[model samples]
Target chain A: MDVLLVEDDYYLADDTRRVLAAAGANVAGPYARVAESLSRVAQGRVDCGVLDINLGEGPSFIMARALKQRDVPFVFATGYGREVLPDDFNEVELLEKPVDPRLLIDAVARACRKHETSEV
Target chain B: MATLAGAMNGPGADRLSALPWEQTPLGPRAGWPGSLRAAIDLMLGAGAPCALFIGPQLVQMHNLAFDALYRDGSAATRALGRSLKRDDPDSSLAKAAGEVFAGRSILLASQGWTIGASPGTPAFNLSCAPIRDESGQVGAMLVLAFPVTSPARLDAGASISELQHRVRNLLAVVRSLVARSAESSDTVEDLAAHLDGRIAAVARVQGVLLRNPHAGVDLEGMIRDELLTQSADQDRLNLGGPEIVLPPKAADLMTLAIHELATNATKFGALSQASGKLDITWKLDQAGARGQQLELVWMELGVAIASQAPRRQGFGTNLLKRRLPYELSGEADIEFRPGGVVCRIAFPLAPVAAMGSSSVWGVTTTAGDDA
Candidate 1:
């Protein structure tokens, strides 16, 4: 599975990227802004995504909505509470910050597998 | 201590019946104001604990329920005829009652009553209402006390949990910092230096944030402190800027970036040379599309071109060129001139403030090219 990581905080972004890469999944561009990620998502190699809501400017809900339309599953990595997410994205998986590597990988596998089985 | 017969009922009434009513500041019972008379009647008829503060002195009178609150001694009864306005003026009840006396009825969620100075005294929920005379002039205060539920303990528990959540979030960020520091280091020593310096920079910012939780760190102070520790002499630096306060997250990243730059200068740039100069300056750029932007420039001169940049494009370079842009939604430019290295960073500053006509951090044009 290919996982696209989008986060602004460099340490968390770099560290999360390492964790996802180590789990044997191909990782896409760890883009910083919405425009950058939105363009990358349009090209279509991404299977799953791990997005941080607050991208310095605003939450990545714009990207989240796009992913939803594409039928791709993803987890939200946030230091903030659930109120930060809207009602539409409430059911999506949430990964709390300083994310545990094993949990992150498992969440990705589950997200991808979830979509796969529903199709089956 | 003869037949005193106060205008009330209850143990407090019994206590008032025993006191020499005509002698104290309260004066004789019949001579009491009509407001006091009515207030006493209302307090005694209450099902819960109640106190009446009467007259200009605001002397206290209570019912059996109010007297029962202090079970150890007759302290609550003794407190009768003591002035809530004057006797224990600093007391919480007195303060609330003062408002009632001012013709405003105040219902408090919780208040401390000086029934006894003894420890483990429970807090009371007090409701103070204005008691007016027959002439419609405010003359007394009627205070009702509810059962104690130990809300202070509950509030402390909530604050502790809030504190715990914050600590855990902070720990997570630190954990990520540890891994990132390790990733950029080429060797064990490099890792230690990178980790220690980055951690210390974070600690410095954390200290400022803790001291002033609302207002953030001043940009000028950050640059001075960061470079001073790098042993860059005061005379070798030209620091200028309009005072800019960076919010917590921005402060953390900026401080780290400054640390990286200072460390590089100390090792190879201006600070390492005998006749070198380092100019650190910043200004608020108001005319940007993204509200206000703060632009900072770190320039060094008099050091050799070989040591201008770190051998590897490590933490400092990546932070200035890449991480800063991603995290701050900003821009950065790092140029290694033959004589030194120059780095310019710009980011949006929130709560766009307009100060007196902005001061220019004069660019020292003489040293940019000593090649």
Candidate 2:
């Protein structure tokens, strides 16, 4: 399974990649900003993406929209409580930080299943 | 004041010693080594009594009222002198010292007899106590005394009753400032803007201390009132929320912040143009076991805007970005869409207790403090 990890924090990105790689998922570059990560999604097909709710400038909701446009499944991770999220994004799953390995693996699996079921 | 201090300081040490309060006096003898006249002048200058030491003996003595008033000072200062074993001797000085050394406290009458060798009726308060030597034996005693003037004597005192008058004067000053600043504006828009500027001038960073008959405000309701007061025609605004009580500072700042937003909307964004409408809403959420948050939403439509984002930080931006977040323990964001500016502010609900009884003006609110 190929995954696109979109997160601004480098240390968190590295740790998340290591855990996903060890779990047998082939992850692409862990892009830092909404612009870079959305481009990677535009360029290729990825099974899933991880997003940090607040990027440097504002919300990463734009990237979530991009993922939705491309038919890729994803979840939100944020330091701010979920209450800070805008209402339109409520249907998507929310993952809290410091991302635990098992939770990340399970969320990815869930996303992949939803994607597959929706395509059907 | 002068008489009060003089009565507190003059002689009658035996009589002063019977009082139950603290008194210390100073006089010419207390200021000896300097000219006795200088000591008297110094005592009179302070309008209070001075501690006196007579001759080489340094026999301790104090007026009865002074001894009673300032027994602690007498007890502490007495250690420097010789212990007198006898009772109140007929010697006016000895009688004063005996009155001081006899007890731990005293009281003074408004009209009292004086102290000293000639026994002149100088108004003063006197007190004294025994001093102990290195061997713990009673050494010479020390006298403490002072004087107090009658209340009528003081010229500068503004009594507590004057507070209401001062408040009224302050209100008049505020009204004058507001009128002065608005002198040039003619149109309604210009007047509203001028009024807003004036309100912001005194708009404490926190909410207004409103005259709530019930004494507390419903914060949600207050925010609506603030928004409505500055809002455009009724057709253009929408508000919704369950009631929440907020202390004065939080409610004030929140009101001002929202006022700025509404003002901006009316002048530049949605409310300015026809067909524009604003929807304001709020809800409470528990972030965790320790934190609670109030999340507010502002949705606008129909107003046309050229910019998708605000290029520079205006006062409104700074208030929302820095002041609201920092002061209220909240975070806010404003986004410019083709439709209008969508703003959201989230704040921690805890710490309101420490903010004290804050009230917002022109808004009604209630809290558990009363209900």
Candidate 3:
């Protein structure tokens, strides 16, 4: 599955993007702003995405809603911790910041497999 | 007493005896303008209550009650009509004056009047001294009464110190914010914008500090540094100007305002395009005491601004209109001429001396040779 990584912090975004690509899934981007990333998702270029809650504004909930309408599953990745998770995302998988590269690979694989089964 | 009579008859002795109070009744009991002899005789009859001498020349005192009132300097007080005004004047005079003025064997109690041998303790309350002359006449007395508690004197120093500390903390916060924001930006354009905005924010806080007439900031060099640092390719940029201290808020806004122009140039204007160069210059003008103005110019070359948004106002527009006016209390004009974008920002120079500081002003020129 191809994943879209969205974060405003450039260094962390670049590092996470490299590690995610190394985990075998094709990675499209780690867009700085939510609006730019949502545009990409609307164009059908992404199968799943990892979202940071704060991309300048309070949270990336708007982009998450856009993905939901397209039936695309995504994971939350943030340095601000699980509390930053939106109230509506009680059931979504969240990967806390400072995450190990190996753990991230497993999480992505698990999320992709779950999406495939849910589709089934 | 025989010597006293001889001195009274001597030359200049009458001058010493006649004081301002001698022209008036020493007390209502004697009716009006009584003779110095009668006043002194009456005072002596009443145990020489409290005597005061109001005259241009030195005072003379011979009363035991007056001498005992002063823990020191009774003879000096007698010589100088006015008590010296320094060195714990309050406590000294308060202890001495209370006994002499009240005609009692108690410690004087003047709460505020300052009286000493020097520029005495300020905010004095009361003063009293025994008056005597060669004739041994004690006429109308001198009493200095004042109120000495000043509210401003109480809190001014502490408030000033607290304000300075807070301003320093704010600058530190601003530096951290700039560092963090710089970390967030991707290209040189984004980094410059972030840094410029952060610098402006700090300047705003400093402006507030400076407007207090307690703190001021250097405007010219600050603007140059913030702008040059914002350039993506720092080595390519050149800077020039003599630094001038500005009113604190002006420093904050002026730097940020000028920096916004530079940021735009690096992203879309002259600095962003290939072969683009930037020259920053400033000068200090003494139009009026209050109209000291700082002039800055951002000149660009070799960058084809036409490739960017030639007309649309994006980040640059917001920075000039919204941030500049709000932060710097100044006006900025940005023009995209045929060759490059030139920006000019001008505003009044606040007096830094009032804040106990000296800020230098001069011209500095820097050019960015970005090949």
Model 3, span B320-358: residue lDDT tens: 654454333456787778678777877655432222223
> In order of the candidates, what TM-score does chain B achieve?
0.58, 0.43, 0.41
**lDDT tens readout by residue for model 2, B47-86:** 2343433322443333333333333554533422232323
Highest TM-score scorer: 1
Question: Candidates 2 and 3: which is better by lDDT?
Answer: 2
Model 3 bad stretches (over 4 Å): A1-120, B1-215, B231-235, B285-290, B310-319, B322-329, B350-371
Per-chain TM-score (chain B), model 1: 0.58
List the pairs of residues colliding in candidate 1.
Answer: none
* A1-120: candidate 3 lDDT, tens digit per residue: 689988654445666788887777788776766556767887776778887655432334777777777877788776444554557777678766655567777776777778789888
Better of 1 and 3 by TM-score: 1
Docking class of 3: incorrect
TM-score of chain B of 3: 0.41
Candidate 1 error regions (>4 Å): A1-4, A21-46, A53-71, A80-91, A118-120, B1-169, B286-288, B304-308, B350-371
The candidate, 1 or 2, that scores higher on lDDT is 1
Ranking of candidates on lDDT, top first: 1, 2, 3
